[model samples]
Target: MTLKSFALAAAMGLLASTAWAETKIGMITTLSGGGAGLGIDVRDGFMLAIAQSGRDDIEVVIEDDQRKPDIAVQLTDKMIQSEKVDILTGIIWSNLAMAVVPAATAQGKFYLSPNAGPSALAGRGCHENYFNVAWQNDNLHEAAGAYANTVGHANSFILAPNYPAGKDALTGYKRFYEGELAGELYTELGQTDYAAEIAQIRASGADSVFFFLPGGMGISFLKQYADSGVDLPVIGPAFSFDQGILQAVGPAALGVVNTSQWNKDLDNPTNAAFVESFAAEYGRLPSLYASQGFDTANLLLSALEVADVSDADAFRDALRAANFDSTRGDFEFGPNHHPVQDIYAREVVQEGDVFTNRLIGVALTDRADAYAADCKM
Candidate 1:
């Protein structure tokens, strides 16, 4: 062959190899057991983004964590060491995120969290390779606390599962809530019974009750609370009143106020499209978890389009730029890699047969996380 032809052939071979290179993502989320609904929505929302991207060069590996920290750790090891994924995302629980994110980021794999931002990761332990697309664990509850103060609630009863996220939720609430606590209770993780807690609240003389019980626990508590006929105002973070479980909670959740960063009715083009598309595809309303998952996937996809995941610095920069339109109208990252955005108070209301949240008012505006100063990176 001529010298020119030989040179041309080599160049074409390199181009072909680059075109076929893959960006593998490992998604470990709770897909079964108690928090299955939240995980399923996240997985589905993430997969929808991948499908919409229509890029054959990107590959995704999904696994069910079953809300177990040990199982999530095992999955992280297998994904990073064996499957050789370039990016890791999708963990629903704070404990699971804690188990997997630090270890994965320490090993040089990029982790983009769709849900579960623990305070430990946000503050002193922040890693350069870790980014949380969702708000820091305290953001919503803090907004709820602020709202409680606005509405003249003097004494509030509070309860949460005894875990890292649960503790963070209460701390977040109390950070802004200047009122005295009527009672503070910690329930067991995945506890199905709230009868005892309800009795305590009934005797505590609290003007309002605030609780952070996600997944099935929320459903159980709300149902039992309604049945007990304790007529105090109820408030919580959006986790308990998410669209995935609102229907299950039914009338029990009606008129309960909660704080969240995203709602289906958010009047932004990106959010409107997301809500419509999610409902059409999944046959249900999208929850805050689903919004976080969608945003996380889009953020990754935006970075992927501009920089290859192998180029760590460029990829991280692109992810941090947050170029894509967010379902939450205005979204930016704090120095700690958690979201800085508005948190709104929403009231659970029934629209036809489906239960959902409606925006009442903004609780916090342009809020940065409490841990940004601690993160040097």
Candidate 2:
């Protein structure tokens, strides 16, 4: 072949390779240990979103931090430096989110939070570079708190682990609950036994109980709560009674009320499609964790369409605009860098072969977060 022809052919090959290359999105989560179920859901949901969008050029590099803060930070740093990832996402725990988000943002990569909205990040710690597709730590609990007031549950008991996220959950509930608090209990983080706490709750004789315990802790509480035979109604945030825990708790969790931003039975066109596709792909119903993950992918894709997102500042600005079709219907970022969305009160129901949650009512919709005023971002 002629030298000019050879050069032209080589250029064509390079162009084809570049065109076929995918946009790499670094996803770090607690893939193993206790939080594995939630991580699996997030991964599956992100993939489902990508499939539905029909965007072949996007890719996700998933890493499991095992719910460890140090591992999370290391994985995030590697993703930013070695992988040269275009975007960063995942993280299930508030501590992990706190550990990694700053580094990811300081490096000027867009950090999309699929879960974990710590109060610190919701207030003055908010950064333009960080965007949370999930509600703030308090939003869901606040909805429950409002529901408590509406239901005439004048006296209530609150329980949570002694952590920043746990504290935020209770504070969120208090934002809307004007009634008298029967009792408040804060246990050590990751404590399994709730026998002593259950005794206290029974003694308190509150009309309703609120709690925040995700993963194994949630399972332990649900099983114990059922065994305790507490006559009063049970209410709390959704994470503790999530799909992951439902399998463990069995029918013990039935009739439980929880507040959340998303449920498997939303019945919206977008959510229905997402749920159907996710269940088919993962062989299980999608939880709120998965819903947030799907929304995060959608959010990133929307920003990518608006602008190239080749640089950090441009991507951050685009994300701040919150231009995406969130599964929750109304998708917008509040000043606190958390989602301004509806919170639903849902009941755990046994749906045919699987246990899933159905919405009881919309407790709050398009509500501004309590801490939004404190967030200058």
Most lDDT-accurate candidate:
1
* C-alpha root-mean-square deviation, candidate 2: 3.2
Give the per-residue Cα lDDT of candidate 1 at 144: 92
lDDT of 1 by residue, 1-377 (tens): 99999999999999767645988899999888867888899988888777777887888999999989999999999999888889999998888888898899999999999988898899999998999998899999999999999999999999999988899999999999999999999999889999999999999999999999987899999999999989999999998899888989999999999999999889999999888888899888888888899999999999988998878999999988988889999888888888899999999999999899999999999988888888887
Overall lDDT per candidate, in order of appearance: 0.91, 0.85
Candidate 1 regions with alpha-carbon error over 4 angstroms: 1-20
Instruction: Tell me how far the alpha carbon of residue 174 in candidate 2 is from the true structure, in angstroms, after superposition.
Output: 1.4
Q: Model 1's lDDT to the true fold?
A: 0.91
lDDT of 2: 0.85
Q: What TM-score do all the candidates reach, one by one?
A: 0.94, 0.92
